[model samples]
Target chain A: MPMPQVPFDDRGLAYGDGVFETVLLRAGVPVLWDYHYARLLLGCQRLNIPLPSREQLVATWQSPPNAELEILKLILTRGSGGRGYATPDNSQPRLLSRRTPFVVNADRWHEGVNIRICQLRLGHQPLLAGIKHLNRLENVLARQEWNDPAIAEGLLGDADGWLVEATSMNVFWQQAGALFTPPLSQCGVAGTLRAALLDHGVVQEAAIALTAIHQVDRLWVANSVQGVWPVNKLLSETGVVLQSWNPAGHDRLQVVGHELLGYSPTSR
Target chain B: MPMPQVPFDDRGLAYGDGVFETVLLRAGVPVLWDYHYARLLLGCQRLNIPLPSREQLVATWQSPPNAELEILKLILTRGSGGRGYATPDNSQPRLLSRRTPFVVNADRWHEGVNIRICQLRLGHQPLLAGIKHLNRLENVLARQEWNDPAIAEGLLGDADGWLVEATSMNVFWQQAGALFTPPLSQCGVAGTLRAALLDHGVVQEAAIALTAIHQVDRLWVANSVQGVWPVNKLLSETGVVLQSWNPAGHDRLQVVGHELLGYSPTSR
Candidate 1:
């Protein structure tokens, strides 16, 4: 395929001035179209980008080679504008879509993953916190904090010492019989899977502190790509420890993944 | 100029995983070349993008232009990578340069710019504070906040009510006997003008509070394009008032116009 053409004045490239969503496609079909669309629309409303119609959106995904799975990226930018910080006078946003091969190691899903607490911290900007805006330097910094063979992911916290989320996923903890997740009102991306879990009555949203994270029986992170990964071991500034085990029906991480993606883990 | 080709997987476009600078070119010469290059190198160090040598950096801008005054946008993206938050393994970043015509109304510079405070607040990320990274949604949001003809540039503050900067420029407040500017340690862009002013012994950097801002006798803003403009009236949450007189070294702002661009306001 020819390289995509974006104007030099594109807000997406210029100011990191846009929002995006990466949806997992199973067998050439977008798995959660409605959920992705809703989140995209919410992002548009928050950033004031024009929301395209559902028909307009789905039409963008052209037929591609038959693959077992794919990754669809939806980018909505504030379009090309005059050379300055002020929004263009007669500006209309651009909506673009592209697809690529998806390759997730199926073995990691079952074996559970190890994560480390990142030294880089996510900032507190309530206005632009929750939505998946393009201003993602924190994620870049967090992801670059460590590059060890053992650490598969890194959890991030705000400057105020509140546990926010993983480098690329929303975090959830099981503590005291209730599922707790960090609220997005302050900071952190509102992941599609996290939203689905909440809307489906799977988890409850609550403020989780950095010190109390060790008390949770099970800790897992969720995003659109990596649906959920149970955090078996957490490495922090203090010390490392294996998370306690829990046995509950739909509350179990294994059961949740099975119900969502129709796959069962080998270890569980 | 033909559009530069960027891969869909390029981290710059994907996650805004990069840094950028827009230098002003006057009579085929870039002003503050050393300062701009230093900032870019510092930003690369902070964002982990490999710093191009000074010769390589200058080579990118070595091109004949159709316009006398041009805006050179230097984009340093963390090149192409697959779906992930981590930096690409042994990946070289993409550095592209494009030139566009520079047009600024001289009248607006001569007369003080009308400004407003934006509803959106910049997040406090100390790690990414001073660098000119690509994650600039806060500026975009603040720029998009108003469409009033009376208001020109908009001021942005951090979540903690600390005075940061404007959408596209660094702000200066002269209270009592000292010239003070907001520190970019936690929020705001460490603008080239701010750095230059400090280097040239124009202003002193300090952590400014919102309550102490009104005490400023004279107010002015500075940027690469528009050098400096004395404030006539400062519209705040409290009320609008005439800015006290303190000759900001330029009564008509033409001194800055000529000093930065080398062309008098009457000439071009």
Candidate 2:
């Protein structure tokens, strides 16, 4: 059967004039409610969309029970509108939530994953940075860079050659016992996991250089769904193989990743 | 009454993963069907969305009775999926067509428009550049740079401080009897008007510099809907006015804008 679909208008389809978030749900409970709410509000403020209240969001998520483990997504758009880029005369934000069974290869999260540098570079637009706004053609293009299921993720670089983040996750590398991730003041989405790690002092933020990335003792990737898994190998642009790593940051990453929604790290 | 709203899972709302076109319909025929169809196909190819044949697009438009001027919008999203950025597996694209009363203030296009430099810098993702893909948070932020009604449009700049285009349209400036526009290979949507102007030998593409704009003899903005309008005032970041513009491009813009649009420029 066809899943029920939404009929969005030009604003949502013409311009990525909205914001969204995917929450990890287990036993019908959405994890990181507060953090996600905060991010959603910030995104609304940034995009000038009148935020549908947090209570409204919560009510929608908890309205009904569904599959035990599912991915809950909240999309907030500027509602339907006419042509042109101007905000509507009267703006009412559209809030929607749906639950679907969340599935992923558990083995990949446990065994270190492999990633390649994508050819597509993210443009630097600070005004639209950090928040998980819907203008993600960059991510879409980056994700489509390869079709090999073996390649777990693709790392993106900004126009100036600065390493930004992975296609769908924030990146962290440990060097000399210090956790460092790229600062997203310019580009890249600040993932929920990266935010938690930053708060817990498990990961640090900095501008990561492409050349310096290989020197890190260990490399790991994190997102709301995929907690954190060390990068076993990185395929450079020239097809040179970088040695695998099991960063010490995994202990903190796994602890939080598991605690968020019971994604315990075990040998797959 | 609240307009129809799409659920968050709408592919248009989710990944900016869709295609769309807005055309002026008058006397029961679309003004620029060929241009809109060509651009829509190009957009579909760029984003990997399957394009409906021109016959399909026109069949829907022709079904409606001929009427006064209307703004016709055709939005196509990958439709709804559970979650994640991947284009939904085997998803049928949602096609939405609506006729809205054409409501642009004629004076803005007739007299001239005030253009202000926006603080929101557009990101340069090449793969998505030139195509009118959804993922328009940058434009939203740019439009939000000002709420002043007098400021007609915001001139958007890229991260490296190069002038990309306006918030919603392509820009053209005449200097020394030659017209120039920002190249869209790195950023900005390649407006249908821009293509027409280039093909008809009306304007040439170039990397517009912040310092060089002041030297131009005249300036104007063009989009499929707006056709072309002069830029009377150019407000810089420091609130300095560039100068006045001669509205000589209107005739040429309208000729190209109306060609094969099935409407005479003088009729409107």
Off by over 4 Å in 1: A62-65, A237-251, A264-267, B237-268
lDDT of 2 by residue, A1-268 (tens): 2333344453655687888888988777887767788888889888878888668887756745566667877777787665667788775666766667777556666677888888878887777789988888778767767777778888888888788999898888777777789989888888877787777787777787776677778787778776776788998766678667763333655666656647765543
lDDT of each: 0.75, 0.74
TM-score of 2: 0.90
After superposition, the stretches of candidate 2 with alpha carbons farther than 4 Å from their true spots are A1-7, A63-68, A103-105, A237-240, A246-252, A265-268, B1-8, B103-110, B246-268
> For model 2 chain A, where is the 10-residue window of minimal lDDT?
A1-10
Clashing pairs in 1: none
Model 2 error, position A212 (Å): 3.5
TM-score of each candidate? Answer: 0.92, 0.90
Please provide, for model 1 over B1-268, each residue's C-alpha lDDT reduced to its tens digit, 9 standing for 90 to 100: 6867566667787788888888888756787777788889889988878987777778766877657777787888888887778787878888888777787656655566767666677888888888888888888778777777777677778888889998888888766666778988887888776777677675788877665666777777777776676666667644464344434343423353346545564432
> Which CAPRI quality tier does the interface of model 2 achieve?
medium
lDDT minimum window of 10 residues, candidate 1 chain B: B248-257
> How does model 1 do on interface RMSD, in angstroms?
1.5
Over the true interface, candidate 2 deviates by an RMSD, in Å, of 2.8
